[model samples]
Each structure stands twice: as structure tokens, then as C-alpha cells.
Target: MNNMIAPSILSADFANLERDLKRVSEAEFIHVDVMDGSFVPNITIGAPVAKAIRKHIKGIMDVHLMIQNPDMFINDFKDAGTDYLTVHIEACTHLHRTIQRIKEKGMKAGVSLNPATPVCLLEPIIDDIDLILIMSVNPGFGGQKFIPYSLEKIKQVKKMIGTREILIQVDGGVTLDNAKEIIDAGATVIVAGSAIFNAPDVEQRIQDFKSLML
Candidate 1:
């Protein structure tokens, strides 16, 4: 897959979401971080918000569910116009079944791993999913520093994937300073939040990231 930027809306201006989204409209995908307090210690938007967001952008909607029981919301998100439904592997009881349900719902299925979750554990269902999301920082909150170890993890995932046509997405703490390094490490799709939205020139910041993409 080609290198792509998925700008996370977690750092966008909630009061002016439409305007903020327009700023990063050129990005390949718009990442939605859906958090439920029980799973991630913070609560964010839900399917209804996603449905509303769908009306504004034509690009891919990469919805990352940081909530427990993600399977129950599969169809909800599908109806909300989610192009990709990413669920945390740490949250699912039956990961394979959840992935199948997502595919059955006509949406691309993605599995996400926390910072501590090793790539080797994903082997059993690696071939079954469409994408693998690597969390560079802990979930729930945004704007945390990217863990240095994530780069090595990304390389490991790349080697483990070998020739499989799977997207390796790195989320959290992505900035212009370390983006190229992360991409070089094997992250196909990058999930950046404050780094892009909090910049003085949001669109230009996104372009800067695009320039670094493969």
C-alpha cells in the first residue's frame, strides 16, 4: 500500500470541527478516535458523531474504536459511513469473529495493538485483517510523546507481514520531526493528531507530512 496520512480529529477544534476538517481535507484519510471511558479512561464521540462527520469529507473515514465490546458497534459505524472500522485487539474477546463481522458489514476491518502488545501475537489473525494499527502512545488521550520503541515494533511488523498486502498504521504523537523516520520504519498509514491540527498552518503542516510520504 502507498504511504498515506490519516489526520486524527481528536485534536481538532470541536467547536469548529467542520472548519478544522476542511483544513486537513487534503489528507488521504480522516481518523476518528472513538473512546469510551471504561476502555481508555477518556470518552470521545460515538457513531452519531461519525455519521455527522461523514457528511463533510469525501475521503476515507478511519474510525479507531478505543472502546470495549467493539463488535456490538460494527453495524452502527458501518451505517455511520465508516470506511474502515479499527478495533483494539486488547478489547476483543474473539478477535477473528469480530474481524469477520466487520468484513461482513461491508467495511474494512483493522486490528490495533497497544504499545505493550507484541507483533508476533498477531500472527494467527494477521492474514485475516485488512490493516494493523500500532499505537505509538497509550490510548485514551492524545498529544503524548511517541514511544521510541514503536519504531522497532514497526520494523518487526513489517518483517512479520512480509509480502502480505496489509497496511501498517502508526497512531499517536506523530510530528514532522519524527514522521519520516516512522515511515522509513514501515508505517504505511500515519495517524497524526496535535502535530497537524495544533500547528500554525494546519494545511501546510499536512502538506509537509505528505511530502515525506513514500
Candidate 2:
């Protein structure tokens, strides 16, 4: 399977976003994590910050909405220059409607599943989504350890999505050592946060992850 690397901005230096973004210029996408205190225990950037970051990034703006009631900000994020907008299955009451709404806004629609959520929950709308994000660790925070079960979940999702064009993305705790395994399990996109940003050499770390795919 072909592999792509997405450097999550959750672990980037907020004080110097431009510098951090520059470090990962080789990445295929800049994974922006939008967190709301209501849905998750922590809070992160919103549409405005995302828009600002969008201006400086050379790669695609892959925005992952970790907020509750994501429908309220779908249009806002689309207008803010999001290339791909992903929402959680647990958050949306009307998931199909939300996916349609995202597609209507001209952004690729993606659905994310938490560690505890089963891949079977996505069976109904799998065809409607452009991407599927499997969270290896609990959402809301970066630098967490990768959950071992997530590998099995990726395999199951890949089997469920057999022959489809959807992208299988694995987020949280992705590092040089584990990225190959994640891809071998059938993930096409890998979202690495602290593994890339917190590394002593950001550019090399990004290169290392890409080299694994090569």
C-alpha cells in the first residue's frame, strides 16, 4: 500500500507555528486537531487559528474535528481552507447528513473512530466517506502511547473497506519504529504528532517516516 505522512499540529510549537510548519514542509498534510472542552477534556485551536495555519502551510490542511456538534463548524472550516474535514462518529447524531454537508462544502469528508468504537459502526457510511481515521490512543491529547488493539482495528477496517478508494488513517503515537507496522496493517495515511514535532530533528524525523513508506 502507498503511504502518506501527516504531521499533527497538536504537538507543534504554538508560539512559533510558522517555524514548526516549515520543519515539516515535506509532509503530505498538516493534521490540524480541533478540540473543544465539551467533547474532550482539553481545548485546542478553532477555525481562526486553522485558517492562519493554512496560510503558512505548503501541504494540505487535514483538519480533524475533535469537537462536539461538528456540524456547526463544517462550513466555517471549509471556508477557512480545509482540504479534508474529518468528524468523529460518536459526536454526530446525523452522520450521513454531516458527511453530505461536508461534501457540499467542497471538502473531502472523513470519519474518525475512537479506540473503543468498533469498525462495524462505520459499515453503513463507509462508502460515503473519503477517509477513515482510527485513533490509536484516547483523543484530546498528544504524546500518548499507541494502543496495541488499534492494529487489529486497522486490519478489520481495511477488510471492511476492501477494494474501496477510501484512505485509512491511523492517528496518535506514530513513530519511526511503529509506522511501518501501522502501514503493514493497511493504513494509507499516518498522523504523527510528538513523534515528528517533539523530535530533536524535525525535518529528519519527517524524512525517516517517509523513507519507511519508500
Model 1 per-residue lDDT at 16: 91
**lDDT string, candidate 1, 94-147, tens digits:** 999999999998999999999999988899998898899999999989899999
- Model 1 scores worst on lDDT over the 10 consecutive residues at 49-58
TM-score of 2: 0.98
Residue 211, model 1: Cα distance from true site in angstroms: 0.8
The reply for model 1, stretches above 4 Å from the true place, is: none
Q: How well does model 2 score by local distance difference test?
A: 0.94
Lowest lDDT block of 10, candidate 2 = 51-60
Clashing pairs in model 2, backbone N/Cα/C closer than 3 A = none
63-165 per-residue lDDT for model 2 (tens digits)? 9999999999998999899999999999999999999999999999999999999999998998899999999999989999999999999999999999999
